[model samples]
Target: MRVHEMTITNDFQPQYLQLIAHRASTYRSDIRIRFEKDNILLDAKSILGMMILPFRPGTVITVQTKGTDEEEAIEEMCQLLENKTS
Candidate 1:
């Protein structure tokens, strides 16, 4: 497994972050995501699980991936977090 810390940018506010998280969850199931502030952890690939997180702007998040394509998953997730486009 691999873990990384990422900061939420202005472009990825609460709504956008939620969308990204939801998307990430859909793309990969062997990943775990945690909200930085509250340390709430959930399966990133589950839409319902991602929605449980109350993410906001400036919120920090920890992403962990474990699987055959863990690195790719992490990279794609990071890109989604940083990219302006959905």
Candidate 2:
């Protein structure tokens, strides 16, 4: 398992959805996205899951991955989340 923390500069924008889908498709079920805040654990890959999150600039997001390619997956996810675009 791998974990990293970063601040989100945008909410669930269209580009974000596309980026997430593209990234998620590259890996097997071993990879997953979770939006953690306090006791909340939401699926980051799901469009609806991301839409429902109370996202805003400066929101801290913790991405976690657990699998053989977790290291690469984590790096990709970090880039996607750090895009900070609309």
Best by lDDT: 1
TM, every model: 0.73, 0.74
Per-residue alpha-carbon lDDT of candidate 2 for residues 23-85, written as tens digits (9 for 90 to 100): 665865344554455445655556666556666777777887777777888888878878756
Which tens-of-lDDT digit does each residue in 1-86 have in candidate 1?
88888876644345665666666655543778778788788777666665556544578888888887788888887777656552
Each candidate's lDDT (Cα)?
0.71, 0.69
Clashing pairs in 2: none
| Residue runs of model 2 more than 4 Å from their true location after superposition | 29-38
Best by TM-score: 2
Estimate the lDDT of model 1.
Answer: 0.71
